[model samples]
Target chain A: MYELIKNLGTWLTSGSSWTGTDGIAHRLAEHLQYSLLATLVAAAIGLPIGLLIGHTGKGAFIAINLASFGRALPTVGLVVLVFLAGGLSMLPVYVALVALAVPAIVTNTYAGMTAVDPDVKDAARGQGMRGHQVLFQVELPLALPLIMTGLRLALIQVVATATIAAYVSFGGLGRYVFDGLAQRDLVQVLGGAVLVAVIAVTLDLALSGLQRFLFRHRTA
Target chain B: MTIDWSWIGDHTDDLTTLTVSHLQAALSAVFFGVLISLPLAVVAHRIRPLRGFLLGVSNILFTIPSIAIFVLLLPISGLTRTTTVIGLTVYTLVVLLRNTVEGLDSVPAKTKEAAKAMGTRPLRTLLTVEFPLALPVIMAGVRIATVMSISLVSVATYIGDGGLGQLFTDGFQRDFPTPVIAGVVLTILLAVVADAALVALQYVLTPWKRRRA
Candidate 1:
């Protein structure tokens, strides 16, 4: 165990591993690229639909069912299927990641919007706020915390799934893991796992902090 | 990229075996998950100060990806099925513990008081009254955990024990789409079936809910 830890420490701190084309820096960038692009596209698609159904209180059945269906999807299956169908490119990674992410965003957004007090909406309307105005100013603000929660959940899940991108010959922190496994290099594998865990925990903490801030701002 | 229908046709036995393996992994994880989570949730519900800390630990555990968890356990569990089950069970803890506690909290104070008035022991009241009333919420958690476990088991392929996820890795390596498609379809089907079965179980277990409806 001591020797293994020493090897891991050496692998993680090695200057060569920190630089060059195949380095941790480049791989981490690629991983974030996949995660962020997919999340942005998902937010573009999911947010509008979620807000629409949530604001109008229609098609909620479809939204909820869609979210559940997304949850049941196997990320590995989807990623590999898309890779096979779409050919080896970044597209499949994005497609699979986006598909995985949209559900949490949609469901949470809808839940947040709907959970806004009916009395608050009534007051906004009575104040002569237009429908769109009320939705934008009153509903959206109140829904920020839940919406952030959804985004946080989506981002975390995407980061995890994005690790599988390396299996398809893409670049990311997962490259270390898959490559380490292939070579039976436990040190590299442990290092990769630690990095991924760090990213996930850091992201969760940052988002949770933001969520708490939003919640506090609202109450104040 | 097209699926080879003929390949699927020749693989029925293999498919069935893989499906069974998949279900066994997922189900056992959920079983042990419930065993561990139920006690934690009970304590969390009964003691107000401990709830946040317990849930927070599970939340952090849940953030770690399934692949990472499996790999992290490799040194200790040596890439065995034990690693898969343990990792998956840890993943289920967040949902199960949170939902069970919420379910227990949903039981009305008045009902618990009435049970206590009848000289019922705390444990007995919990088993007979609170647990029964909490069944619906707890079952919802079970459904979510079942689906989650089913999907996550596919990622266990990298660890050499993903069950149906084997088909995915095979097809990916062979650059064939048939097994991958089959794996995807079957996984989704298994999750849906498991969820539906749980729904039915909840209905049967909560007869009072049915009577009211």
Candidate 2:
């Protein structure tokens, strides 16, 4: 255990310098930025579609099947597909990550909307609330918790998968892991693993906090 | 290059063989995962402190990238079926263990108390009462783990394990769209069919859900 700790420490500090072309910190930051941008793009598109489909309740099966297909599509495969289609660099990575995030966001959004208490919706409608007004005023607020849950799940997945973008020489933290493996450096490999684990746990905790905050606000 | 359906049609046998291999890897991983996680979950549930530690470890494991895990394990397991199965099994623990604990915990306290009042042994009570009640949630976790393993197994192709990922890698290497598209389509189909089968199994195992369905 002590040896393990020492190795981990050495790896984390060894990669501290960013003077080289492929600095771990620089790669991490770039990967994170790409992941965040991709997730935001996915949420922007997914949330609206989720809301529209969820509101109409007409295409639930199709929406769900599409999302399931999205989830099943491997990130690496998608990245390869995008690359084959003349998309390389960060664009393919972004597209793949967005594709991955969409299903969760869409599913959760639809579920959250549909799960809104029927009585509250009916009461809002009875009180001269237009369809749009009820959705905006009541449904969206109530569904915020679930929607946030979906966002949280999507965020973690995006961050974890962004490492795969390194395979295309896009220079993400996955470079550390893959390159380390190629070079047979356990220290470097462990460092990359530690960085990813930290990001995932931190994001998860932060999102849990956000979920709690949304739930509390909804009740209050 | 123009798409060639004829070439793919001729290679349907190859596709079927690859699908079989993929299913073998996923099932082996899920089988071992459930075997290990169930007992550990039961033991952890009985001991509160151990439960927290187990859950923490599993949660940490959950965050590790599947490819990274495979890469790390390959040196020790030597690019064999053992590496892929072990890596995927570890991944399943993060999902299965949590669900098992949650499922058991969700069993109503009153049900357990009544069983004890009838002089049922602790083990017997757990098997007879708690296990049945928790079957649905446990099955749900198993379903998720199965799907996850299937998807992650594609990455195992990097370590010389052949599956649908072979198609993807081969396609990429040769710049052939047919194999890549075929691999993607097959993977999606596998996931959907597996998901549907699990849903059916869940229905069979938990008859109460049938009413809801």
Candidate 3:
């Protein structure tokens, strides 16, 4: 155990590990790039659909089923299937990650929007607010917490699966784990896994903090 | 992409074996997750200060990615089925504990007081009165955890222990889409089936809820 820790410490602190194409810096950048792109795309697709169904209260069955179906699809299968079908390109990774993320965003956004008090919405409407105005000014603000929750969940899942992109010969922090396994280097594997965990936890904390901040007024 | 029906027909036995193992791993993890979480949730419910701390820990555990958690356990548990099961159980604990705690909280205080007035012991009250009332919420948690475990077991393939996930790695190495499609379809099928079963179980267990609905 002691030796494992020492080796991991050395691997993490080694100057070579922080520089060059294979460095942690480069890998982290790739991880964030894939995660960000997939999330933005998922948000673009999910947000409008979620808001639409949530505001109009129609097509909920389809949206709910879509969420559950997306949840059931394994990340690895999606990536490999897309990779094989789409050829050897990063597009497959983005596609898989985006697919993985959309359901959470859509579900949470819809839930958030629908959770808004009907009376509150009615009050806004009674004050001569238009449909879009009520949705935008009232529903959106109240639903921001759940929407952010969905975004947070999607981003975290994307970051995690972004490592799988490395499995398909793309660039990301997952390269370390796969490369380490191939070479039987426990330090690299552990170091890489630790880094991924750290990033995930940091992101979770930041987002949760933001969620709290956004809803500070709501004791519930 | 076109699916090879003949390929699936030829691999029925292999698919069945993999599916069985996949379900075994996911179900066992969920079983253990509920077993462990129920006690912790009960204790957390009783101890007000401990509730936040326990929930926070589980939240952190949930935040750790599936692949990362599996790999993190590799050195300690090795690349075995045990490692996969343990990693999955950890993931389930997050949801199970939270939901269990929330379920316990949702129990009506008036019900507990009425039980006390009827001379029920605290333990008896908890087991009889509180638990039955909390079943719906707790069952919801179980359903989510079960589906999550089924999907997450695929990540165990990286550690050499995925059940149906093996089909995915097989297809990838062979550059064939048949097994991959099979794995995806079977996994989703298994998850949906499990979720449906839980919903049924909840319905049967909460007849009062059904009547009210």
**In what order do the candidates fall by DockQ, top score first?**
1, 3, 2
Instruction: Count the clashes in each prediction.
Output: 0, 0, 0
Candidate 2 residue runs with Cα over 4 Å from true position: A1-8, A182-187, A210-220, B5-14, B43-56, B105-114, B206-213
lDDT of 2 by residue, A48-104 (tens): 999988777789998878776776787777888888887556777888899989999
TM-score of chain A of each: 0.95, 0.91, 0.96
Q: Write the per-residue lDDT of candidate 3 for residues A1-220, one digit (tens) a residue.
A: 7899998999999999999999999999988988999999999999999999999999999998998788788989999999889999998899889999999999999999999999999999999999999999999999988899999999988887788988899889999998988888888988988998889889989989988987899876
lDDT of each: 0.92, 0.83, 0.92
The candidate that achieves the highest lDDT relative to the unseen native structure: 3
The worst-scoring run of ten residues by lDDT in candidate 1 chain B lies at: B1-10
Best by DockQ: 1
Q: Between 1 and 2, whose lDDT is larger?
A: 1
Q: Docking category for candidate 1?
A: high
Candidate 2 vs candidate 3, TM-score winner? 3
Clashing pairs in 1: none
Q: Report the candidate with higher lDDT, 2 versus 3.
A: 3
